[model samples]
Target: MSHVYQELNPGPFERKASMMITTNLSVLINDVLKGAATLLNQNWAITAAVNVFIIFFTVFLYLNTSTTSDQVTIRSASNNAFSGGNTTTLKEIVFHPNYGGLWKDDLALIKLATPANFSEGVKSISIAKSLPKQGTNAVVVGWGPKSYFSTTDGILREAVVPVMNYETCKQKYYPIFLFTDTSFCTAKDNVGPCPHDFGDPLVYKNKVIGIFSGSFDCGSTTYPAVYADVTQYNKWINKVIKS
Candidate 1:
């Protein structure tokens, strides 16, 4: 049996443009990357020197006041799940606003009111710095509905999924607008994040490489589910943690 850390029932809410993407923050980093590229094009040494300065001087943080169906609560990994585990309150939640703050930039960094303590069943997982390659096997756990017709489960559930090619995901979600440059989709159906699974971490090699963003339907093999690529937001996360 896998360990379940957090559990949440976000309840019914709007789906369209509700998935988190982190486009707003990505734009800022893109600008930095662009500036670095320009300098590199001129002279690699100068660019490298400036890169270190920019990284050291940058302190990116933003406030979000929009309503969201997602919530973060830390709990224990006992068989009883959240029932016996301690619950942690959220101190702050950060996300980027883009595309009218509708769908793009869907990822959020949640700060707990109190720092967690590591114990026998409580530990922290690493977030991947590099993107997982296509066809990589990953695991996702959440307290979402099992299917479209099913109600949200109180306990956490997990599913194994394969990382699909970004190009293939773009093709499948073309008309619907998904799988952005900073997003990717998993393969198969009824085996990944379902409704209300937003913000769940997609684990690869015991590290989180993706975040549950959205899906057209629960357990749709064709569309699978979209997740915000964690590696794309590495800078954003690093800034938050360092601050």
Candidate 2:
């Protein structure tokens, strides 16, 4: 199992970036050639050459295959967010704001807070207040890495994006507005949530309220990063817990 986390929509480079393709191709060619040899009674040296070539190709392909990582980074490299002690905390919880925050639970402890307000998707965990923060402006921290397809497994990253008005976000991603309860959306920017930032925190007012879910593939000027509306998911979360 590869450890690198994926973020953002798979761009052209990412789409074509499958490492397994080479392996698959090699296996198929080997099988086909071997089968053909039985029918043709071909020379063994030639078949052996193909097998050697396949091994070389497989090695190269494996090296070249890249896994997409989280784009978030800490503003303060020295600060530790989780355990408290550092003067500045750097990490944040982020929602992919695109891919439905798929790996969220793995990265974050998805807790359903009691005294539940009518809000959706709200969960709470204790993190140090000392770490670097974006202030009232929401911040996200994720365990996914920083580069797109660079490592089979990567580290977590953190970033921040402004939350747009709900009406404005509705105009941006209407279908999501209709179906999924995203509290708000962000304008299109390199910072907009892309792929792997799942279970990242969407912090506002010193609270980790949002989880990176998605607006992964679907994007436009209006439709940028979309997230799971923690305020809206309150009831749903409670259901899971109470059950």
Best by lDDT: 1
| Tens-digit lDDT string for candidate 1 (106-199) | 5545444555444433455556888777888887655555566665534445556788856778787768774477778786644555644555
lDDT of 2 by residue, 1-243 (tens): 011123345532111112111111101121121100000001000011222233334434533444111111111111122212111111222222233323222111111112222132222232222222222345544433333343212223335456665566566654644324344554434443343333344555554455444453322244555544555444443343343
What do the candidate models score in CA lDDT, each in turn? 0.47, 0.31
RMSD of each: 13.6, 20.4
**TM-score: model 1 vs. ground truth:** 0.65
Off by over 4 Å in 1: 1-82, 97-103
Backbone clash count for every predicted candidate, in the order shown: 6, 50
Model 1 lDDT vs. the true structure?
0.47
Candidate 2: stretches off by over 4 Å: 1-136, 145-153, 174-182, 217-222
